[model samples]
Target: MRIGSAASLDELFDLVLEAAHEAVGYESASLMTVDPAGDALTVRASRPGRLVGTRVPVGPSISWQTLERREPIIIEGPADKALGTTYTKDVPFSICLPMMVAAKTHGVLNVNRTAHPGSDVPLFLRILADQAAFAIERMELYGDLQHFTGQLLSQDEEHRRRLARDLHDGLAPILVSAHAQLQSAGVENEQVDKATALLRRAIRETREILGTVRPATLDDLGLVAAISAAAREMATESGWTLEEALDDPGPLSREAESTLYRVAVEALNNVKKHAAAHEVRLALLKNEDTLEIDVADDGHGFETEQWGEAGVRPGHFGLLGMRERVAFLGGLCKVQSKPGEGTTVRIVVPRDRLR
Candidate 1:
């Protein structure tokens, strides 16, 4: 049997309940998710749909026994009075299966019927419960991964901002002072002129580095302004006819603004380096509760099927990194391209999440 592709915790619960009903018939079925405190189980999904949100504390009940024993518990008599439900009380036969993965009980799957199920039903239910447990475990691990990645990205950006500030405030001023001293020395020697010229270049390059590291426009202005600045720079360098439809997204958290700006810059850089087109369209729009940024290029497109292989090429990891960054913000990054068509990179993030 296929297993383990449920997207969210709720969906996993519904799948487990549905699978229980299909694999072994049940008059009523419910999936209980273990609370974070591990002291109770909450009915997240049920076949009758009325038991949702019902909470059952860990007590001397069959469900609790199944969880503790890490096995299926078959009850042939009246429903446990601790359940405190007329629907459960009416059902004379029930089975509570522990959803265990790696010797850890995540939850319990309860199935009730008026008559006893076949002798092999427990085995099948146990298998189904195990699969559901594995899916839940995988989903939890993925959630943890996304949280860690978000933290790492935030820290990395903070480090870059700090380094940029040091260069702008600490190093750039020293270079400027050196240049001024050389100019005031009243020396027309070729060596002095060369030294002064190098100092000026260094100052100029330092400013450029500061801009690239963390653009001041991003913090002072906002995401739209920062993206427009980046887009114009890339357009000038690539000689692409740039069309922009930027809208102010109002105030956003520092992290959200930074993530959007970096993703936009990466998209533009990819176009400048790889796309041999003459036209590019950049858009920053706030639609409903979402903030969207789109970078489309009328370039010679390649098969998107090669996206994975392309990421391995030199200077192409940005494509994958862009997606990961957006995902970290609970957003989506979509790349649509076809040969002889064009390429469009769109990122949509929930506005509330930005806060």
Candidate 2:
């Protein structure tokens, strides 16, 4: 009745079975939810006791007709000896109702009466069906939310992979070439020391950009080597000293490499952009089956939840993107940050996925 306010699944099942029994006065009343894999209705709850997960084959149950028509089905007296011949024989009147949500039927609510269920039985069956339909809608809505979150997380990871590739192949080379030209010009204009100083500054800028642009070294090397290289570069450019401890060897996958690389890049960038802290720590540790890449910044931190979807910011919009990338690889990306305290980003991908 008030099942929508149910606190537990068992509580909700109790409501459905109790209503089915009181209304139709059937010898037994049972609830069968749709089973996609079994391609039939599998009993979930019953009044006279259930054969838990009992399946009524898809082909011949009168439930199929109710589901197909999205309406109540009544087999008065005898059902013309049609589908469910054996089941119909045991009961004088059979009623089936399709449980629906948003006009889509998910399963059927079946009621059978050993004694003829007069017209009132049909109306009562409708009430039980309504309650069940609401419950199914709520469940389906919850399922939709889970599916959506998964998809969003997946899409984010794909975006990061593309961003990482762009930073490496697209921007890194351009900046490197610019640095070479600046160095060459500095050599040629030594007579003008001020001009030479400007060239040197430009070269330093290119190096800083390279720190973020370089290809994920983990993919080329392994996790340890890649993190080590990234640590050196981030230290050199941002002046935010970083300490790193890497464990897993060259066996990690290309996707894992990309994931760790993105995590470091985002962590270092946060240090330079907002952390204001003087140092950071990067660790790639393995605890049994889970591989965790941890990036901690000593700088001032902010509320992780308030960062909005995928962490929003202009010019330096990478953290949210990094989380998305981690999710796609069947991994989790978590950021722990408190204002004026510190910030830590953890990217943990499944070991099997890496394998």
Among these predictions, the greatest lDDT belongs to 1
User: Where does the lowest 10-residue lDDT sum fall in candidate 1?
Assistant: 307-316
TM-score winner among the candidates?
1
Q: Across residues 1-355, which tens digit of lDDT does each residue of candidate 2 receive?
A: 5767666555666677676775556766667777767478887777666466788776756777777778888876667565554454477777787777666676777777777767788787786777677776666655664454344345554554565455458755664565455555646644345434544444343333333333535557666776677677767877877677877643766656656676666676667777777878888888787888888888878877665665654223366566656777798888888888898888887777775
After TM-score superposition, what is the CA distance of residue 109 in candidate 2 from its true location, in Å? 1.0
RMSD list, candidates in order: 20.6, 19.5
The superposed Cα distance between candidate 2 and the true structure at residue 106, in angstroms, equals 1.2
Error of 1 at 128 (Å): 0.4
Candidate 2 global CA lDDT score:
0.67
Score residue 214 of candidate 1 by CA lDDT: 51
The residue-by-residue lDDT of candidate 1 on 133-161, one tens digit each, is: 87888788668745643443466767767
